[model samples]
Target: MSPPKTYLITGTTSGMGLALVKHLLSQSQNVIATGRDIVSRFPREIVAAHEENLRLLELDITADVDTLQEIAREAWGLFPGGVDVLFNNAGMSAVKACEEASEEYIQQIYTVNLFGPMRLTTAFLPLLRQKTTTTTASSTVIAFTSSSAAWTPLPFMAHYASSKAALSAYLESLAKEVNPPPFRISVVGFECGGCVTNLGQPRQHKQQQQPQSGGSGGLLAKQQEEKTVYGDGLGKLVGMFTRDAMAYMPGDADKMARAMVGVIERVGKQGGGKVPVRLVLGSDAWESVKQKVEETQQVLEEWKEVSWGTDREGVRGGAEGDYLRAVSIL
Candidate 1:
């Protein structure tokens, strides 16, 4: 009999990662869950019960390359056989405009959203390759937790959106490069439209700094800009933010887990064939994706003539200009 397929998931302490981990384990699949605060912040009972299958590895995806490599070595040592699926589920979000956002803020977001996942995936590729080569596996899948925001541009989230967009492009290109038998890349952009997750929490650094209102012109200028730009939308965004502030789901976590498991099993059965690279988890997410696609298509169709540059051809090299050019040359 074949052995149970193994999975290595990052950011397993909360949100979709936690949900995915729980669901995979319930199916009796072996999962190695990594998180920044695996030992301290996580619930004791949860980790204690799943100790056999769940190896708590301390990993901050945003850490330096050397540190990440060390963590990867430790993880590989613990799971020598390698994982069938590597879910890059850890990420972060920023809520400020691109211009207003600090360089540090943008860097932090990219560090977690793009570089961290890329590093982790790169580290695990050898092990994944080994599994495919030795077992004649159909394909090994690497899934990423991308956002709906990746597709649709959103106000005050240029940095977050840009990072996901870059990651998406990178994954798409990487999949093409690694096209070989039993070795495949599957990127799942988990468009969690308004699901409950702790992604809305205020930035830790911002809270620590706590902007003082004392006669600082810069502070007032920022406040004024925020008021002008955010105004009514701020309230709505905040409400949605509060809703997804934790991993808890209004819908059953198990059901969501089942959906993910089904997708993974389907991919496995198909022998590593490409599945829908984008999976909209909830109804809201589906609606949003659909609307955005439709809107984009409409805009493209509307501007097709101008975008194609056919309309400007006559204006650029018409009879009058052709006549002038011919005379001038003579």
Candidate 2:
């Protein structure tokens, strides 16, 4: 008999995470769900309905290492053998200029979006590393819910964008670290585009309050100064992108969640499993990322000579002919 497939997801309280939980449970797969204040807001009836396969554990992701260790112990008890996937779906955003973000707010964003996932992933290493390679199950995947904003830098939400960019780079390095034989773990990043979720709005509602659950720091939106050098232009650009562009975004949260599950299923199929490190979802995400790549490449090419000249003679236009495949200014 095939081993029961189990998925562990964080930030399961709302939005894509909530949708993902329902979708996985409906498929008769075992799911371990976690988030802050699980009892107060979550509907426990759903877990009761799927008692055998669903387990709910409340976790404060921004908590200390001891707290994370406790949560990992609880999670292991639920699935003692191992976990098939660790979906790091939790993230936070702050609608403020980089300079406008407080030390507290920046720390909060990185804590939930970046550090929290790292802590949990590290804590679950034993269970994750126990994944068997011979099985038909796809390579054990540790996925992160990244943002398209990572590619396109916006003036207001610089922290969120940079955090995600760092996440992608970190995951890429992790992919190289864990793959190619003995270690079967695979790292995949989901660059989810705008969906119909209250992701950025709550930060606005709880601006005055201390940073807590999914603190978006929307309160800082008020800091956009119309008189600042590029203030008006930045405001219009951000407004049009966030409001007008999102108004017509094609992807739905639930649908995206389902599609993600489908992709996971394909990982260890009959054909050798293939999990692309970066999965960019939605038409809007594809277009925006593509534009950013093109723009960057164009800028790089325009300054190729000056940029490449910094390399020592042996490294650049060296006698050994450009230190192997080292790029040179034509």
Candidate 3:
């Protein structure tokens, strides 16, 4: 049999992260699982029994830029064969009115969801390049756990949705540019639905530096502009997310983990064949994706004449087709 693949996954403490790690280990695969605290997440018995196949490390995704790079390097050293997949799975959730959330809190959520994950991905590229150079097998994967909220931005979870949406957009473009004609490196956005996880519960939010009352047209101005549009606010969302509601969310964390692992396994099976840029999991998420597509199509159709109106003579649709034919990504 071929050598077991090495996986470096973040946020392995609870919810989807923990579940995925558990599933990987059950197959006797080598896993480098990271959390803010190792002992809190992994059982002592499991760690002891699987010590040879497992490596536990403390990695805070929201740490300073240098700290993230340091831990990533350390993680690389932990697996000499090189990382087959980098699962950017760590994230936190805050439930508050969008304006009520301080600028610092918004920055924090984006750090964990977007910037930090990108840093880790870039840090590991050299190692991934080394793997592809040596093996010439399927491309190395960088799969991030984006949310369906990205496609359908909610009122209460505006910041979270924005962060996830931006993350997905970045990965979509990055996947195309990671390497040119000679190589194919897969970048996947594993868009998970509402899984039963600690993500729904509130975490400590860092205090925003600006005084709540005094801020003039900077952050407050942006907040006011948004509030004007979302004036209806999140009353219904708040009511829907009672404690029991959170506990009764439709997504099962374990099942979601298995689904993610299945994506990785299928990609590996390809041995460098085509892998999808995005996989929208869960029935709710699938429906949400469909809704977005339908609505986008409707809007495009309504504006098609206006859209074409801006175009010069004969090159309306042909321009885009010509560009794609030049690149040939399709």
lDDT of 1 by residue, 1-330 (tens): 656677878777666677788888777777888776566655677777887777777877777777876776677666546667777877766467555677788887788789988888787777666666677665367877776666765666688778877887766656555544555544454544444455533335422211110011111112223444555554564455455533222334446557766776777464655466667666655676799889999998998767767655556533587666533311
Worst 10 residues of 3 by lDDT: 208-217
lDDT of 1: 0.63
Query: Can you tell me which runs of candidate 1 are displaced by over 4 Å?
Result: 202-236, 239-254, 270-274, 310-330
**Root-mean-square deviation of candidate 1:** 10.3
By lDDT rank, best first, the candidates go 2, 3, 1
Q: If scored against the real structure, what TM-score would every candidate get?
A: 0.77, 0.83, 0.83
lDDT of candidate 3 over 144-212, digit per residue (tens): 888887898766668878888898888887877764434456778887766666664333533211111
What ranges in model 3 sit over 4 Å off?
Answer: 137-139, 179-181, 202-232, 243-248, 268-273, 312-318, 322-330
* All-Cα superposition RMSD per candidate: 10.3, 5.0, 7.0
Model 2, 216: alpha-carbon shift in Å? 10
The prediction achieving the highest lDDT against the true structure is: 2
